[model samples]
Target: MTVAYVAVAVLLSIALVGSGIAKLTRADQVVTSLTGIGVPLGLFPFLATCEFAGAAGLLVGIWWPPLGIAAAIGVVLYFVGAVGAHLRKRDFGGLSAPVVLLLVSAAALVLRLLSR
Candidate 1:
């Protein structure tokens, strides 16, 4: 079960970390994608940085519970916002993937918390 949680965390970290880098580097592309979607381009890098930190926290937390728990929560919060944005865009197709990520992250968090 610990291993399962760790595995989920690792996968989530990969995705969230990559997304952060893209948002930081490709703000224009992100702005275009979120076109007329109300999210400011200026905010992309900030949010991306948080996501990246959360991802790194999750990784470091695996060996250190306190950080991992915090990161897990942070990532889950990030996903909740992601789910909201996707829904707001009426992009049901796009919503599914993020939903899965949210669920997996939530599950992993639960597992980690219980383990401690």
Candidate 2:
């Protein structure tokens, strides 16, 4: 159980950080997708920060279960919002990524709790 949680946490952390970096750099793809979804450009920094913080919490959570759980929850909510945005914009094409992230984050939350 612990091994599973660790694996998922590490993978999720990597993904979150990578996404955060893209947001911070304003990668063209990210910018295009976000802007198309009606997300303001100014909010990119805050969104990136949330991803960074969630990644950090997940990494530290390997040793501290509570933090990991909280981070997982935050990540889940973050993706939920992402999914919502896509749906709101009727951007079905861009929906898969956030949906995948949401499922994975939810998995991390359950795994962390069980591992604890």
Candidate 3:
């Protein structure tokens, strides 16, 4: 079970870190996508920063369970907002990725809690 938890955490970290880096480095693309979804372009960096923080927390949590749990919870909340944003914009087409990430983050949180 610990192995499984670590695996999920690592994978989720990869996905999130990759996304964060893209948001930080690829302003034009991120801005366009956010605008299409009715999100403010200015929010991109903030979101990216959250992602980076969550990713770091997850990685650090491997040694400290509480941090990982907190990171997982934060990620879940982040994705909830993401889903809400997409829904508000009626951008169903953009729902899948965030939805999947939400599920993954939720799973990680659950697993972490159970492990503790």
- Which candidate achieves the best TM-score against the true structure? 2
Clashing pairs in 3: none
> Candidate 3: where are CA atoms >4 Å away?
27-29
Give lDDT tens digits, candidate 1, residues 1-116.
67977888898889887778878787565656655456777888788888889889988888898888988888888889988998898877666767987997798789779767
Q: Estimate the overall C-alpha local distance difference test score of candidate 2.
A: 0.95
Q: Write the per-residue lDDT of candidate 3 for residues 73-110, one digit (tens) a residue.
A: 99999999999988998888878989999999998888
RMSD after Cα superposition, model 1: 2.0
Candidate whose lDDT is highest: 2
Off by over 4 Å in 1: 27-29
Error of 3 at 50 (Å): 0.2
How well is each residue in 14-79 modelled by candidate 2, as lDDT tens digits? 999999999989999999999999999899999999999999998899999999999999999999
Is 1 or 3 the stronger prediction by lDDT? Answer: 3
lDDT of each: 0.81, 0.95, 0.87
